[model samples]
Target chain A: MSEQKVDTRLWSSKARNLSPYVPGEQPQHANLCKLNTNENPFPPSPKVGEAIANVLEQQAYDLRLYPAPESDDLRASLAELYNLDINEVFVGNGSDEVLALVFASFFLKERPVLAPDISYSFYPVYAQTFGVELVQIALEDDFSIDPDAYRQPCSGIIIANPNAPTGLLLSLADIRKLASEHSNSVIVIDEAYIDFACIDETNSSTQVSAVSLINEFDNILVTQTFSKSRSLAGLRVGMAFGNASLIEALTRMKNSFNSYPLDKLAQAGATASVLDNDYFEQTRQQVIDLRKSLTTQLTTLGYQVLPSHANFVFARPKDGNASAVAAKLREQGIIVRHFDKPRIQEYLRITVGTQAQHERLIDALTAMQTYSEDSETISNMG
Target chain B: MSEQKVDTRLWSSKARNLSPYVPGEQPQHANLCKLNTNENPFPPSPKVGEAIANVLEQQAYDLRLYPAPESDDLRASLAELYNLDINEVFVGNGSDEVLALVFASFFLKERPVLAPDISYSFYPVYAQTFGVELVQIALEDDFSIDPDAYRQPCSGIIIANPNAPTGLLLSLADIRKLASEHSNSVIVIDEAYIDFACIDETNSSTQVSAVSLINEFDNILVTQTFSKSRSLAGLRVGMAFGNASLIEALTRMKNSFNSYPLDKLAQAGATASVLDNDYFEQTRQQVIDLRKSLTTQLTTLGYQVLPSHANFVFARPKDGNASAVAAKLREQGIIVRHFDKPRIQEYLRITVGTQAQHERLIDALTAMQTYSEDSETISNMG
Candidate 1:
C-alpha cells in the first residue's frame, strides 16, 4: 500500500505523465531464435577483448582516476575510421544519447524541427522530452522520405539513414541536396545501420552512403553507433561526426552535464574495434550476404520485401496476417518484431541472423502457411 | 573562417543561451600533483579488474546484444551493499547522470527547487538545463547548510551531504528530520563522499545506511557513486536508492533515453567493487588518516582548516589569499581546488592524496608561506 502511494509532486510533469517506449522482446528462453531486436549475430573483434585485457594489465588503478572526460582516444580513432578530424567528433553513451544531445543542442525553440512522420520511434520522444516544436513530414507512399518536404523554414531537420522498420535508405546525393538546400538549418543523419548500408558487393545500387554527404556541408551532423556492426550493442558507445563548430556546441553541453560519459573499458574496447578493419569487413560482408539470401527466400514465398540497406529486412506476409504469423513463429521457439502502429502495423521487421537462424525463421513461416491452408479447408468442409 | 561560425539557432535557449558549469581544471601538463579533481590516487580493488577480464573473455561476443536496459546484477549487488531490495535502486552513468535524472524526473515544473547557494555547482546548471525554476538558499557564515531554510514550499530539496568544496557534514538526525518534515517533497541526499565523511573510527556512518530511512518515507532518494569511494570514476557508474515508484520513474526515463547506459565491462567491474568490502575499507581508512595529517600540517602552517569529514579538506590560508596560495602551489607541481565565488572565495578545497603526496602538498604550502611572510616584511620596510 505504501508502494502504491507515490507523491505526484516528486516527479517531473513528463516523468509523471510519460508513455515509455517498449523495446522488442529479449526473452530469457534458451532455445528461442530472437529476430525481434535488430542485433548482429556475430561477436565483436577478438582485438576488442585483447585491448580490454591490455588496459587491465597495465594499471588497473588508472580506472580509479577519471577517464578522459571527452573520450579523446576513442574520438581520435573514430575520426580515422570515418576520415574525419578529431575536431569533428562528438561521442556519447550511445547513438540514442548522441541523438538526444542533438535535439537538446541544436534542434529546439526558434522554429519547429522537421523529421519523418514514420522514422526512428525515438525522434518524437526526444522532441517531447526537450519540449521542442515538431513538424512531421510524411514518407512517400513506398515508405521513403521526400527531401523537398524539409525545404520549409524550420529550426533543424533529422533523418535516420536506412531508417528503422522500413530499412530504406536516403542516398548521399539526396542527403547532400537536403543539406545544401537547408544550409542555415542543422541536419542530423542517424546512421545507426550505415555499416549494413555500405555492404553491397559488385558496386550494387543498394549502397547509399550518407556519411559522404558530410564532406560537402557545414550544417550536417552524422551519428553512428558500434551496436550493430561492431556487435557491441551492450557497450553503449556512439559518436557524432560534424563540423568543428557543431561538435564544440555538443562538447560544451556534454561537459556541463556529464564529463566522464565514456567509461575506461569502453574507450579501450571501442578504440580496438575501430582498429580491427578485418573484423569490420568480415562481419559486414556476412550480414550483407545473409540479407541477400533472406530477401530471395521471402520473394519466393510471394512476400513483398522492402529494399533494405540496414541490418534487418521489413516485409509483410503474403498469405496470412502478419501478427498472427509472428505469434505462430514464437510458438515454435522463434521471435520476430511486429509494430502495431499506423502503416507499419501490417509489416514485421526481422533482424537477419546466422544461416541456421534464418532457416528456422523460414521453416516457421512455411509451417504457419501450411496450417492456415489446412484450417481454411477444414472450415469450408464443416 | 567557417569553423569559427557557431550555430546560434540549433542549441536550446538554455544551452547556447546560458553559461555552463566549469569543472575543475585538468591541465595537460605532466608531473603536476593533479589534485584539483577529487579522484582517488589508489587503484580500485584487484577483484574488479579480474571481473572485467572475465567478462571480456566470456561475454565480449554478447556485446551485440543490448545490455539489460537496467543493469540488474549491479543493482542487486548495490542493494545488498545498502541492505535494500532490488526495486529500491536506480543506476546511471555517474552521480552526475543520476542527479541530472533527478532534475528531469523529480524536480521539473514544480514549485522552484531549493538548495544551498554554495552547494554542488552543478545544481543550478541542471535546473536551467531542465527549464525548472530555482530558489537558492545561501549557506551559513561558516559555509554549511542550515536545513531549516529548506522548509519553504518547494518541489524538492537536493544537498550534497558532507557537502562538497567545504567538506562539512549535516548529521543524519538533521537529514532524517528534514525528510520527515518534507515528506511530500522529493529529498535527494547526494552522498558522493560519505565514505570519507565517516573517517573517524568512532564515526562509522555510511551513505548506504541512509537507505533504511526509505522504509518510513517514499520521497527520499539517496544517490551514491562508484567514482569517489569505489575508486571507479573512469567507469561512469552510480546508483540511486529510493521508494520503488521513484526508482521506476528514473528507469522509465533512462529506458526512453539510453537503454544500455552501463556497458559490459562496467557492470562486471562495478559489481566486483561493490562485493569487495576489504579493499574499500582499507583505502577509506587511508584517506581518513591522510586528511587528519593534512589538517594538522595546514593548521600548523597558519591556515584555518575546517574539521573535514570527507576525503578533502577545506582550508583558508591565514595570510588571506587562497587563490594566490593555490596558484603558487601549482607552480611547484601541486594542484588544489580554489573556488573564486562569493562565499568560498578565500577557501581551498584540496583532495587528500597518498601520504607522500600530502607531504609534497605540505612542503609546497610551507615554502609559499615563507615566501609570503618575507614579502610582507619587505613591504613593511618599504
Candidate 2:
C-alpha cells in the first residue's frame, strides 16, 4: 500500500505512483512444503560451490578490486553455451535486472509495447517503472498465449515462455511467425522456465528455446536466468542473447547504470554452472520427471491441472475452492501460491518438488478429500 | 564511441541517444601500480571471506532458493552501526546502483536538480538514464563546491563529499546551511571516500558523515560504499542511510526494479564487514596513513597536490603534461588516472597504495623530471 499511496512532500512523482512488483514470499521458516516461489527443490551443483570457494581462496585479496566491468568471463561462458558471439551476450544481477535494462534499452519508443495480460506480473511493474506504455492482450480460455493475439503495430512485444502461473508453452514456429511479422520491433522471449519445458508427448525432453531463431530475426532477444534451471537463485546472475547491435545497446545502458552488476563470485559460479553439462542435464531431467509425476498425481486427485510445461503447475480443485485447499495444505505445513488476481483466482500454482515432497502433498490432499466427504454425509444426515 | 553512436533501427529512442558513462579502467595487466579506479590496495576484512565461506558451506543447497529480497541482514547491520532504525537503511548491488535508484526515486520531477559540475561523472549519466533534468553548477575556481552556489529552485541536489577527482571536503557547517536552505529538496551526500577522510589536522578522521544529519534533516540522504572503504568492491555492496520516509521511497523504487539486487554472499559479507570494527578501522587507518605519506612525497617531488581527504590525491605535475607523465609511468608498469576534461586537464588522480607502491610512483615521477630536463638540454644544445 505504501508503494501505491501518494506522498507529495518528499517522494518523486515516479516513486509515489509506482506499483512495485511483489515477488513470491521467500519465507525464512522451515517445516513447510515451501512450493510458493518456483525455486528448484534440489541444491545447486557441487561445482558451483567449488567455483565460488575457489574465488574466495584465490581472490579474497583481489576482492578489494572491482569486478571486470563487462563481466567477460560469465558472458563468454554464456556465449559458448548458447552458441552466440561474445558481443551478443549481456549479463546482469538477475533476470529481473536484465529485463529492466531491456525495457530501458528497447521499449521506450513512441509506440506501446505488447504483452500477454496473464503473464509474468513484473511486466506491468516494469512498464510503470520505465514509463513505457504497455498493451496487454488477453490469453485464450485455456490460458495459452495466442500468437495471433498480438496483432498491432507496437514498439516491442514481451511474452514469457511456458508463461508463469499457467505453465503452457508457445511453439517455436509461432514465435518465428511472430518475430517475422514484427520484424521492425524487438520481441523479448522470457525463458525463465524454458528449461522445465522439456516435457514433450514422446516421453522425452524437447528443446523449446527460441535462441535458434535469433540469427534469422535480429529483432528477437532472448532472456534467461540461473534461478530456476541452474539453481543459483542466491547467486543473482541473468543473461540476454541477441544480435550484436541490440546487445550493444544493452551494454551501453548497463554501463551507464552499473558497470559491474555481476560480482566476481557470481561470474565464477555461473560460468561453472554453464560449463558443467552433466550436472545440468541430470538435474533438469529430474525436474522434468518430477513434473510429469506431479501432474499425473494432481489429475488423479480430481484437480483440473493445466498441461504444464514448466517447473510449476496451475490447478483448479474439484470443488473449485482453490484458496481453501491451499489454506488447508498450509495448515498441514504445505504452502502453495494462490493469486488474488482476476480470472485465475480459482487456480493455485504449485512448484514441482522432489518425489517425496510430492507424496507429502498428495497425502494431505487425500486426507482433505476424505474429511470433506465425511462432513458432507453428516450434513445430509442432519 | 559505440555508446554515443546512434542507431535508430530496433533500438529505443532512449538507447539511440544515450551517451553512457565510461568508468575508470580495471586493467587486466600484472605488475602495475594500478591506481586508476580508486580501489583500496589492501584486502577486505578477513571476516568478509569467512562470512562468505560460511554461506557457501551452510547454504550451498539453499543457493537454489532466492536470497532475501530486502537484504535484511546487511541493512540491520548497517542500521546498528549507524545508530539508526532498521528501516532507515537500504542496500544495493553497489553504490552506483544505489545512486541510480536514488535518481529515479527522488529526482524525476518537473523541477530540475542541481549538482556540482566537478562531482562524480556518473551523476549526469544517471540523470540521462532516468530522463531527469540536471543543472550543473560550476565548482569554485579552486575546484571546490560552493554550497551557496545551489541557487535555483530544484527537485534535488547531489554532491560527492571529499569530491571525486579533486578530493575536496565541504565543512559540516556548509552542509547544514545547504540542507536548511533546501529543506523541501532532497540533498544527496555520496560518501564513497569518506572513510579515508579520517586524517584531521589533529591526525584523526573527524566524523564527516552526513549520516549525522539524517535524523535532523529528513531530506538529507547519505550513500556510502564497501567498494572504497571496506575494500569489498568485488562484493558489490553499497548502502544508503536516511530517514524512514526517504529510505521507504528508495525501497519502493528498488523493489520495483530488482528485489534481490544484493546476492546472499554480498549480504553476508557486508554484514560481517560492518560487525568487524577492528578490521575496518585498521585497514581504513592504514589507507589514511598511506595517503598522508603519498601526499608529502608528491609535494616534495614538485607536484602541486591538492589537500586530499580521500583515498586518492589530485595533483598537477611541474610541467603539467599529465598525459606525458602518465605515459612514462605506464611504460614501467605503473598506471594512474589523468582526466582530459577542461579545468582539470593538467591533473592526475592517483590512488594511495602501500608504502612501496607510493615510493615506486614517486621514484618514477622523479626519474621523469630528470629525463625531461636532460632531453630539454640536449634539444637546446643541438
Candidate 3:
C-alpha cells in the first residue's frame, strides 16, 4: 500500500487537541498486585460464570441473530433489582459509555454543563467532543463537592458520589438537594463507587453505600458499574436508573447510535451477577474492610490519609514527597496512581489490594522512609 | 422525590433537533421469519460459543479484573484476518458504533462528508449527531453509486458496499480511484455485506470488494462485521482496518471515551468466530445459493429484482405496491422491509433466509398474487 497524505482537516478541530483520559495501569506481570485501578479483589458471583457459559452453549444460531435491540430482559432484571419499572433503566457497554451517551443526548448543549474541577476526567472530554459549553466547579478545601456552588444557570449536573481520587462522598440529603435545585435539568449522580460507600448494616459499619439514595428523586439518574464491587471490570457492564421519560430518551439515542449496545455474554453475565445478591454483598464487605484497614495503616505511618468510601485510599506522606514514594513503590513492582496535577500532586491514590499486598506496601513505605531520613541527614551535614 | 424540570438547553443543539434513526422491526414473536432487519437466519459458529464458554469457565478472578484497556488479543486476530499489522486494527461494539466514532472523530469537520443519498439511512443521522456537514450525492437512475459524483472536494467518503436496502456493491477499482483522487481524505467502505457479495462470482462478475482495495491505499478504512456471515449479530462485534496512523487516531479517541470497548465474552467469541473459516464460508455460500434461487423465483413472478450481491435482494413487485406486498406477507408471518422514502419507495428488501424460509416466502408471494389479481379484477369491473 502506498502511503498517502493525511487530511488533518477532516478530523474535528478538537480531535487533534484532545488529551485523552488515561486509565489506571493494566500491568502484564501475573504476580503484580493490581492496585493501580480500584478493582475488587474478589471474584464475581459464581452464577455469573454459569449463566455466561449457559448462554454460550446455546445454539450458535442465536448469536447469528441480533440481540434484543433494547436489551429488554436485562433491563427488566435491572428494574427488578432497583425496585423500578423497566422504563427506569438504561444499560450500556459500561458506565463510561452510558455517561458518554447521557452527555451526548442530554448533558451537552445550551448552557455549560457543571462538574467538579477535580472529577472523572472523561466528563470534560465528553463536553469537548459534543461541543458543549463547560463549567467546572472547584471542590471544597476538603476535596468535597459544595452542592450550593452548583446553583448556577447551568444546563445539567454530574457529581461522582464518593468521587474518584479523593474517595469522598456526598450525603443522600446533599444529593437530593442538588437534584431539587436543578429541577429543570438532569442531575446525574455517578455512583460508580456507591457499592463500597453504602454499607450493609448487618455486616459492617464500613458498608455504607449511596445506592439506597436512588429512591430520593426522579431527575436523578443513578449510575452504577459492576467494575469495582462486583469484580466484573473486564466484563464491561454498567447501568443507569432514572425516570421513565429520561430512560426513554437515552434508549432512543442508543438505538440511533447502535441498536445492540450490550452483547449476549454481557447481558447474561451481568444479569446473573446482579441476581446473586449474596456474592455482591460479600465482595463489597471485603472491599470495605480492606479500605478501612488501609486508611488506618496509612495514618499510623504518618501519612495524611483521606477518609475514603471507595476501595482505594489517597494519602500524602508526612516527611517525604508523595510522588517520590509512589515512584519507589513502582520500582519494586507496586503500581499506584500518581497524578501530576496541582491539587492532588502531593497525594498518592493506591488501590486496596488483598491483605498480603497491603502489608508489602506498608513494608515498602517503611523502608523508603528510613532511606529518605538518612539521605536527608547526610545532605544537611555536608 | 421531587420532579425536576428538564433543562432542554443542556443537550447539544444538534442532538436536540436530531431525528434519531429508527431501526426496522425486531418483532417479539420467535416464530416470525425475521427478515426485516437483515439478521442472518443462521447461528454463529460453534467455536465462537466454545470460546465464550471458555472465558466464562476461567477462574472467576479474570472477570473480576479489568480487561486489557485495549482488546489487544482480539485486535491481533482481526489484524491477521485482514492481512494487516496489529496497529492497523480498531475494534468496537459493532460497526455502527465504530462508524459513529469515525464520523465524530474524523469525518465531522471536514468539508461535508459524502455518501449516496439513498444509501444506508444511518449515514445522515450520524452526520447530524456529530455536527458534521453532509453533502448527499444522488444515486444514478439504476440506484448505484457513481464514483464521478464524489469528484468534488470532500472531507471524507462513506459507502456501504452491497449497500443496505439495495445490496448493490461498488467495484474495487472504483473504490481505489476514489481513494487515489481524494488522497488527502479518508475513504470508508463499510463492507457489512462483503462476505455475501464475494460468495457469488457470477452475479457480481464485475464487482470487487473494497476490502481488496485497502491493499492499494493508506487513507482507505474497510469495516467488516461478524454480524452477517459469521452469524454473531447478537454478539455486537465489528472491526475497522486501515493505515497504522489512522487506526492510532481512532485508538486515541476510544481511550478518551471508553478504554474497554469490547467485553470479555465478545472478545473471545468474536475472535473464535472470525477464525472459524469453514463456518464463515459455508454460511456465506448458503446465503448466496438462497439469494440466487430467490432472485430467479422473484424474476419469474415478474418482480423487478436488483442485481444484489449482498445476502438480501431488493425487489419491487410487478403489479403490486411494495408496502402492500410487505403487509400482505406479514399477515402470513413473514416480514420484509419496505421503505417509504423517495428513490427507493417502490422497493422491498428481503433477507436471504434458509432454503425453507425462502420457499415459504415464494409460496406466500404466489398466494398473494392470486389475492391481488382477484381484487384487481373487481376494481377493473368497477
Per-model TM-score on C-alpha atoms: 0.94, 0.97, 0.92
TM of chain B, each: 0.94, 0.96, 0.93
Instruction: Please identify model 2 stretches exceeding 4 Å from their true place.
Output: A1-8, A199-205, A375-382, B1-7, B199-205, B375-382
Instruction: Order the numbered candidates by lDDT, best leading.
Output: 2, 1, 3
Tens digits of per-residue lDDT, candidate 3, A190-290, equal: 98987787534345545233445556665777788989888898889888888766776676677667778888778888888888988787777888888
10 residues in a row with least lDDT, candidate 3 chain B? B1-10
For model 2, how does the per-residue alpha-carbon lDDT over A104-129 read when each residue is reduced to its tens digit? 99998889999999989999999999
Q: What is the overall TM-score of model 2 with all chains considered together?
A: 0.97
lDDT of 2: 0.89
Better of 1 and 2 by TM-score: 2
Model 1 clashing residue pairs (backbone): A105-B11, A106-B10, B197-B309
Model 2, C-alpha of A292: deviation from truth (Å): 0.8
Q: Each candidate: what lDDT?
A: 0.83, 0.89, 0.80
Q: Whose DockQ is greatest here?
A: 2
